[model samples]
Target: MKSAELNYPTQQQELLAIVHALAAFRMYYLDEPPIVETDHKSLEGLFTQKMANRRLARWYDILAEYQPTFPICPERRTASLMH
Candidate 1:
């Protein structure tokens, strides 16, 4: 399943909401690790960089806590889904 959102000023908020939705899905259905597919490169970059604005930084920490060893693959400008 994929969640696609428009790139608006509230992009960060939208992404966080999507993350929560995915987490809920994981808890209710899939017990195994789930690879969340996102088109937002900044979202992936934020997690990969491991830093962000005050509020986003907190979420980043929480996300990092969940999957302590997830991989961050860099994608080319023309590629969809980094790597």
Candidate 2:
């Protein structure tokens, strides 16, 4: 994590991981909105709820391009992988 990123809240850090992964392989996911599996309990609300953080705003802007879906997978099923 970058020095500045260390200051981000846990939720933002989790979202950052998603954004970074998506940006890294955008081409393969462009045709279809990728399904991200995680146990992040608020994954659903993360995209729907409003937030005031600038980092989240920027990350959402980047994520908007893919419109990624974050599924609430069971802990055993969620290995931080895309399905």
Best by lDDT: 2
In model 1, pairs of residues that clash are none
Error of 1 at 63 (Å): 1.6
**lDDT by candidate, in order shown:** 0.55, 0.81
1-83 per-residue lDDT for model 2 (tens digits): 79998887777778888899998999899789998777888666777878777767888898888987776878756554545
lDDT of 2: 0.81
| Candidate 1 structure quality by residue, lDDT tens digits, 1-83 | 22443343355765577567656765653445555554455665555564546767766665654553333345554285335
Q: What are the clash counts of all predictions, listed in order?
A: 0, 0
Give RMSD (Å) of candidate 2 vs. truth.
3.6
* lDDT (Cα) of model 1: 0.55
